[model samples]
Target chain A: MVDMISMPDDSTTAVDRALDAVLTRLAERAIPRGAAALALIRAASDATTGGKRFRPALVVAAFDAFDGDRGATPGLWDVAAAFELLHTAFVIHDDLIDRDIERRGVPNVGGTFRSRARSLGVADDGADRIGDAAAVLAGDILLYEAARLVAVADIAADQRVPLFGLLDDAVLVSAIGELADVEQAVVPGEPETTQLLSTAHDKTAVYSFCAPLAAGAVLAGADAGDRAVLMTVGADLGLAFQLVDDLIGTFGSEAQAGRDAGADLREAKRTPLISLARETSAWPQVSSALALAPTGPIAVRAAQRELHESGARDRLVALIGQTLASVRRRATELPTEPRALIERLATGIEGRIP
Target chain B: MVDMISMPDDSTTAVDRALDAVLTRLAERAIPRGAAALALIRAASDATTGGKRFRPALVVAAFDAFDGDRGATPGLWDVAAAFELLHTAFVIHDDLIDRDIERRGVPNVGGTFRSRARSLGVADDGADRIGDAAAVLAGDILLYEAARLVAVADIAADQRVPLFGLLDDAVLVSAIGELADVEQAVVPGEPETTQLLSTAHDKTAVYSFCAPLAAGAVLAGADAGDRAVLMTVGADLGLAFQLVDDLIGTFGSEAQAGRDAGADLREAKRTPLISLARETSAWPQVSSALALAPTGPIAVRAAQRELHESGARDRLVALIGQTLASVRRRATELPTEPRALIERLATGIEGRIP
Candidate 1:
């Protein structure tokens, strides 16, 4: 059923065009402001490039499923592009918070500016601060740019308010989720399982899944009931995706995940897996290994081995499986086209679990 | 003549109501999210409080001047509130970029979080990072909240797009201005007078004055010619206001300005005053004093004395006067009501010069 509509590739192309249009307009605006403005715009362009466009895909899928004349609607592409812009904004800020200078094996916005400042002979700390400021400004531009796109999108007047509301809700919820994540890191305690799962849901699921799906439904003039169903399905899918992502971050090969396998452990990030592992018998060895100086490869291996041997890995995998099943069940209430898309996305996420 | 419309007090009251309404709506949304979300909401409330409501006053004054109904429009209040929210967001982010943890003798949003984290046993740098994260999230929320208020406000549908565009332009321009400021600090070169003044205009004037006035004109359904006149007046007023602010930051008493007088010299900020001072005979003394470690009272006094003795302070003050005269001349092109308001506002700004 999903094959009837050629997804993702076509959707990705349309969204790219939409994004290009936005950048062109921004460039036109920046040119009059001078070189500094132009440089910031260029940095914005670089930061937004090369993402998988996952959120845009969900927006397109839901919009296509709900609207009969899907491909004919150019506004759908702008809507998709807005989600991608929002995602880029979040990614830039997240990198700044993590003090990470790289993303996707390249210099992120902060890293790029840090390098520029260093080349100009700024001290290390001064260069880092400049990089942080640039990242903040870049994120600010994209954040408002996303709202501006939605406000100007060629949709019905009545639909604009709801879409704006959805975007606002998503930003607020995601910020709270991020705050909780940061708090857990510095507050010196093990987060409860429910708190950990809720943090994952709020931080990752709401903006990435729920809002995009709902925004698509709103753009397509879907009824409230159908929109609610799609959002619930998105919630389940998003939670499952985050859990699987955490697993990949901890145990998957660097080549497969495109990130360091030991990063979460090195940072002592409290995830659902970590929360569960804290109660296991192998926790002592895992804790002691984590305590070793330098947190080298030996410690990471011992921690991973203990997690696997204690069955925490299996439990988390089971949790992910249950979450995906819930997505499938909730998706049944949506229309057939969206239901198929949701199930397919879930399956793709499931494939990430080792 | 300005007394015919009862000036800022009434406008301030209306703006307060609007800001309160925004906080009320935000609190209602946060209640269900948990304690962390509520803490964020509280921080936002604190951050938004106790400002002179300067931008909101501009919004209300311009709106009332254009619209005959005056105090009858509720949407005007929301519009005013939106500008205030925007201002608060900028202030928070600016403080973060400047590494300032205090504002107006109080702990800012970042400082509040940093203190909390420290009390909870986090080390200095870790607490600072946590605080930076909180400030980022807080600013993000207020930034979008500003847009959301504008989006949901009760106004003609067509007016919304232009207002959104105006807000978008202001945000982007202000960001570029901030980027230029950061770049100048790290790149280690004397900035041209034109560049310094341009940065001030972009960083302070557009969002602070032009956007608020233009937004008010839009809400009141004013003609394009009238709107352009007000924006031009805003540009001049904003430029003059910023020039005066820099002068005050350099030479005014702390009790009068409610800020540390020597802070700008200590930071070696590149304002028009500093740019002009670089060309004077006293440049050597000022430069050497600035290079002194600790940047204590002696260095600040020597720098300030050199600025005055070298005539740089007088030049900046004269520039401010000329800018204000230009604003008054431009006001002649606006309607009588708005013209009165603009002249009064410009006079108040002039009073700030030391």
Candidate 2:
């Protein structure tokens, strides 16, 4: 396992400082807009905290691999922080779409506002409505803030357009992926494996991995060939990361995943694991267990057990291993430092326990 | 009344061409992403159509005020089109927040997706959920597209930052305004007049009026003093426009308003008119009528009658007039062309039938 705690302390500190500066600037801007405005900013600030800072780490790592001077090129931190903010915005919207009130075992932006409304004597439905509205607005402000950070990053004038273009493309692709994911859930059917993988790539990989790594390359004035190599490596690592996440989400403890382990089944989310399990000898047992009120602990556990016993889990594990190997192979095109960082990140994703 | 039909033909054509180019570029970009992405781009395209193009008109007008040569400075049209896109984005989110499926008497983005889901046999709740997710994604894409247009516009490099800064400020202020507006409706007490007005200014004025004008000024390389004057004028005009909209929303025929006339009453929205009506002798009658299931036509009519008879309607009209007068006074400081355009826009807003 590539321990997350082993990330270089300076990069982490730089990202944290960049984030703090962004939030402080936002707070300063909101001071004159009144308390309601400030409250929304606070919600955004809270939502941004507590993530593992993985995306920003990729940015910093790529920048470092190019020998970009951290002190002289502080805007790289802002670029890194922009990715974090974008992730927070996506998380807020995703939670709203999923009707999830809590994230990371705490009240999310929507949950925070919902509680506030309920404490003020609002009814359940009314509070939920207020909460949804707050979440939408909160997500919106963060989204703009993210874009604003990129637009205003003190980089070489010629580099600004590419950075903005990359950010815009990431936003567009992510939204498309999210739409596809939601459509898969609503349209009753087994989504094609290819379709599901495409959704996963668009929904998570483009923004979380590809953009951040490529953005760092852009900042470092790396040639197109190197940037393309980084993006390909980023995509492979991102796919591996998401596959692990699905594994953890389905079979890991709540403490391991920081969310309910049974949520994917309860939601009837058409994940690759569920799809792969359909092809196995234990399909009947897994399907029956899932059909029997999947929200219940017994049903969830039965399905989990059947999937584990079916060899589908092993198949997925093999698939992830293959993906990581591909990433490692591709990282050979890069210099030593970035290649090592990519391999470590892939290893860390592979080591996630379920 | 400034006739919408009488907008300068050249400017209107320029704005239309700019919007078309933007939509085409988006479509081309989505070609490789497959059917789902193209569908989203189509929905965003649909949402952008059929509005008055009022915001873009302001951009063109402000640009024209400085003799910004349309033939040489075509980016002015992109700037104008960005405002329209921003407006469409806001409208999509607003409809989602209001839970309205239709906008301007047609199926909105959510409604279109909801209908599609139902046609595919999804249950009502499932369809609504799908619809909401689609709307959220659709709005997000348009919002980013707006910012992207601003970022990529072929203006002077020095001019780019100010335009971006204005766009960011407008987005931030508008979100704060929207949150405050939602809070007013959710909270139990009558909202203070000052709070309501602030919400009106923040929610509607900043993006719809101030930013578009300021952005145009930035594009023209106008002096800060002129830009500031135009912003003040835009604020006054936006306030007048919203106040008139509220009047039409409550008192105009459905045909005139292009939406259900009774929606605000049914929603029990705390508009300035409602707040002012609370202080009048008609409060008892209005309260009773509203207490009797405000969704019904009889109750809505009774409440409307009380508001009209209590002179609150006239008070709001007078407020609109005062606002228009202020806009005219401020516009006097601008160059002749912009002054005329601002005054005409305000007059058109005031002339809406009720």
Candidate 3:
């Protein structure tokens, strides 16, 4: 099962406090827009809470690794909060795109707004429209707020441009990755390995690992070489992390992953495992089972068996191992603080790799 | 009717060149991602072209009005280009949200992608998803590019903070206005006049007028008083602009407006005209016709007639007149160039006010 019980630490507490500060500031401003606007902001605020906070942790840990004099900087918290907020916005839009009604064991942003609209006695289609529109706007607002936070951050004048560049690139590239994903799933053929890898790197690796780590280093006045190294390490780790996520998504139980199991199969997602399985002797059965996925659990189970027997799982495990090793190797080249933090994250990712 | 026939002036050409430079740079980098990614960018580039370029004109005119030695600054073009890019992004998302299939007399970004998917033999639902997803990502990329352009702009360090603030606030507030729009349309009751006015200011006035004008003034190193005045003038002009737009949407011919006439009535949109009609003696007929809108064209036309005969059209004309007058009065407080530009735009709007 996914761990939700880590000991309360100073860094963790600080991140939470930063998030609360952002919400408080936004809520105060939301007051003037009256009840409807206030309700929208509150929904956004609610979405920001209760994530794994993994991205923020990476931001702080990466920054801490540089051994910068933390006392001299006032914007570290804001930067960390900005990463989490970006993640919040991404998840909100992702849920809407996926038509997912639940996230983190509760109604997601779209679902929350949909429920609210229904309670107001709107019709079914109208309620769906309201919910989707609310989620879209909430995501948009969070994105603006995130950029605003970083734009107005108390960073050195020289650092702001590069930092904003990194942030913007991450967001832009992730969107490109998301489009690639939709194209792969809908284009009526098996997706190429290159396309899948590129998508994974853009969507998960860069934002989750690369951007936050590089940002932290940049803030700490790292040189270009150091920044490049951090980016490489983050990208590798992020890809490996996503592989593990896909593994859990398919093979693990709902209780372990905090989501509906078999959703990937039901959606006919073209994961690496799925594409590789298509190359095996069990291709016919697996493809047929995928076609019958939602209505026929037996068929889906058959597909799962085919994937395992076809050695796709073993192949994915090997890839994850190699990727995580690369991350570790890169981390050792960094300073002691970052090396230890990255090593820890790598180990955590390793446990879930298969 | 939008005057799509405006001659290409120096400012327009400058904005176009900036956009072309951005596209060229992105196109170079897009080589590694293959055809799909490149096609997506091309669609975005296409969406950025052939607009009235009104926002950019405002940015340039307002900056010119400040009488900054035009030859000294290098970033005005970038800032002007940023506004157009922002507008492009907004229109893309707006089309997606409204499910509008056409824009600028052809298939929009979403429709283009949807067509691509369909031609590739994808199912109808899958094609629709592809289209919507592509539009979302395209809009997102444009927003990032806009911010990046501004962040790296060669403006003074002191000015970047406030400029970013104006940009962020406009985006956030516009999203709120969009949400208000969806809510107003879906909810059963007549929308309050206050809500309509607020939505207009937030969606149209702030971004289209106030932000551009203020941004221009700030770029030209104007004092806070001058900047504030420009914002007031912009807000008034923008609201007047939107009122004229609403009037055209209701009363103008399909050929003139370049879309299906009575679309607002068919969609049960809560324009000020609709709100006013609800208060008139024609309420029953208007409401009944609205209810029957999608089933028959006759019902839609009947609602249009009720709206006109109920005196709602005259009332909206008067409101537009009063709002435009306020715009002109505010403009008289500004420097000559912006005052003339605003007056010219005001007169253009006045022709469509009824």
Candidate 4:
């Protein structure tokens, strides 16, 4: 059903441009469904497009890799969209759960809704309540719309059947992971790093990377074995990606972090770096240094040193090296060099640790 | 594409019964994809089937009235399932918003989720919070899944083009109505009867009856003129139906009510009778009576007397009677007699108030 000849060749530059046009059209068509949907889509797109375009790029790359036609089926666009929808849903609800203010230089959906309600003369308690409720619904709708779009995709029925199931599995796994995250938040913690990593794999790796990558591969008519290879590559890369992200959130500048400095620190999120820091006894001194920072790069440097001495930095570099080697090893099993591409992205993302 | 000649006659009892079987089966297939869809689907079926089967009946009745063959494509089951799904979503979210405990003589989704979390050793506040979150997501899945099911129906693609759009419109309206209702809850003073009725009409009338009925008509190949009639009849019937339900809730015995005697009173919901009582300046006494002895036939008799003297009962009765007449009038437009059956059901439902 996905004829390779349908895709635009590398010489044709308009395919990427055409995607923007189609996305705008989709947005326009989606808005009239209702005011609430319009508001939500607007908010979601703000954060969605603000991030790195890695996910969408994967759809294009995988298609190209498999010699699958980029223009073959518009279904590829819908699949990419499905990924954004699920990802945006997570980000919105995650921001709400975490009580975040700014994300990627934009107010989180919860904060925006709350501010809007207040400007309309709603009381603070009621505003907060309404904001939470609206955010929940918005996330649900975004996720729903993504699935709906996939269902309504004008692809072969056989191909479409598995899309929703994959999506459903991703949603369930992510939801359970969120539950675990929520539970961890309330517990008087010092939870094991393994438990936390498992949560990351379920909520982050599987949904964020494996599902979308495998979806793209399947769209390109990748064989079962190819899909299996992509799955492993995706999970490994995604986990590494999250670890890097968590590292940047703590050690990087606010601009680079796209979050408050020491965010996971404040929330006491059980990121791998945090666990490693604690396991090596760097946490005690690092934690004390965080509380006693002098509000400059000097404080940041000192904390970094404490972290390194605790073996957190060394372990991270070692893990990345190991993961990179694994990716190099695994790519031999599949064509298209997706493993290489994922590693490249992982490398760029993890570079923030310095 | 909705081939009629291939359809079994609605007059064939076995054909109609088999259609129900199909609809039931469709509702039962939650998701092979994962636990969340399965959780949501199970919750939907449990909550949906436990009701009076009124909404589904309206859809079936409307379809059969046009001589629309249920077996025409077997996909009519999708339409039936969609209606129930929407209803289930609305009720689940509505109960959570309203903080009601019982729906159909069992704990609503929020209550069930909360109880389950509590049993799992989650803290009370944490459990309630998680329950709210889960219920929100679950309700959304039901609404989205309903639309998904509708799109899957093998209807004439041209006629069904706007089916999901229409459902989306209904969903947005219902959610806004929810927002408005929640906003209106603390307004203290009684709203005008017209204002209260308008709010009630948008939130409950269309959401509960008109929209579902209209959607069913769309599925059955009803013309615009036919749909207008259906909506009108459905809206009026919905209002009257809710009024009767309010009365029963306010005054019925424990066995008869199967719900709290003064649930509306406690919640300070804007029901017609309550609004009427307020406007007539008889609310202080009646409200106190409602508070003191909102149980048994004596209360129903007292409320009835108060409603009568205030001219409220007569007005409501006249309106309901007119609406029922319109339903009768519209029945003639149907290609079959299921319209008459629906009309009779409406009458029976409305007449049970005393």
| Candidate 2 per-residue lDDT over residues A1-354, each given as its tens digit | 236424488788888998998888888999998877887789989999878787788777777778777666768888899998999999999999988999877999899989888887888888888889889988987887788777777777787788877787788889888888888887876888778778878888889888888888888778888888888887887788788888887888887866677677776778888888887888888888778636588888888888889988898899889988999888899888777777778867877847
lDDT of 2: 0.82
Model 1 misplacement above 4 A:
A1-8, A71-73, A289-299, B1-10, B68-73, B285-302
Compare candidates 2 and 3 on TM-score and give the better one: 2
Ranking according to DockQ, highest score first: 1, 2, 3, 4
In every candidate, how many clashes are there?
Answer: 0, 0, 0, 3
Q: Write the residue-wise lDDT of candidate 3 on A63-144 in tens digits.
A: 7778766677778778878888888888888887767778876888788888888888889998888887777778777776
Model 2 segments more than 4 A misplaced: A1-7, A260-268, A291-302, B1-7, B260-268, B286-305
TM-score of 2: 0.94
Name the candidate, 3 or 4, with the larger DockQ value.
3
Give the best candidate by DockQ.
1
lDDT tens readout by residue for model 4, B33-100? 24443554455456655444455556665676666765664666566666667777778777766566
Residue-level lDDT of model 4, residues A47-84, one tens digit each, is 56554444545666665577666566667776766666
Candidate 4 CAPRI classification by DockQ: incorrect
DockQ of candidate 2 is 0.65
lDDT of 3 by residue, B1-354 (tens): 245113248777887887787777676666676776787888898898777777777778777778765577678888888888888888888887777868966988898998999988899988888888888778877776777778777777787888887797678777778878888888887788778977877787878888987888888888888788777877877788777778767777776566777666666668888887777888887777778876656777777787778888888888888888888887787777767767877887787654
Cα misplacement distance, residue B111 of candidate 1 (Å): 0.8
